[model samples]
Target: MSKDQVLDPGAIAARLADLPAWKEADGWIVRTYRTHSWKGTLMVINTVGHLAEAAWHHPDLTASYAWVEVRLTTHSAKGLTEKDFALARKIEEVVGWQPGLEGGALEGTPSDPRFAYIKHGR
Candidate 1:
């Protein structure tokens, strides 16, 4: 819950192996992408719907013709946790987001072409 406490990289890495696109942020994990159009956004949403149902976890999503932003956090944990990291990884796997991208809650740059710009949010 408190950012002051550090999460163990080994344990977190094990849980995050399946999720390559998501990354640890200050308090949460996130991913973002550009959709081809409005319909593409709907398609992405529908895909996430199935993923959410399967994982029984959901993310905060904002979508438009050009972009979709996904943020995952464990509200109950009040900060990053195993659950949050797990979901973050899963989303990345499903969406094909590369790690160390700017879309996460941490600071970094990405060399991928899908994202025009990626950044962390408060």
Candidate 2:
């Protein structure tokens, strides 16, 4: 995916089909990861940063104590693009991580508050 190419609605929809956990919102593809604790939140942010850095396509991150929202778009392209989807896919791979397990379950305690900010499975 070229960083310079902006994806049209059809193309965006096609890409989004493969990324069910993400949605196109306010001109960006976004996903919010819920974590069990403050530590989990930081872990997610750090992991996202690492992936963004490695891919050279960054996402806008908003993180609180137990969740981090990642929004991806090609800033230079001024719209959604393949690069955004590529990065989003990579992020999904790492974000759905469970230690010593292959995407077993989300990492979080069941006792955490079920607020909007606190996503399920943390």
- Which is the leading candidate under TM-score? 2
For 1-122, candidate 1 gives per-residue lDDT tens digits of 34333356665566556555566566666666666556556656777767877877677888877677777776765655666665665555555543455366754334454533422231
Model 2, global lDDT:
0.80
Q: What is candidate 2's lDDT per residue for 1-122, written digit by digit as tens?
A: 57678888998999899988899987899998877678778878999999999989888999888789999988988999888988999888777744434345554334436422234353
Q: List the candidate 1 regions with Cα displacement exceeding 4 Å.
A: 1-26, 97-122
RMSD of each: 10.3, 4.6
Q: How do all models score by TM-score? A: 0.57, 0.79
Looking at candidate 2, the ten consecutive residues that score lowest on lDDT are 109-118
Candidate 2 displacement at residue 107 in angstroms? 13
How far off is residue 3 in model 2, in Å? 4.3
Model 2 alpha-carbon miss at residue 86, Å: 0.4
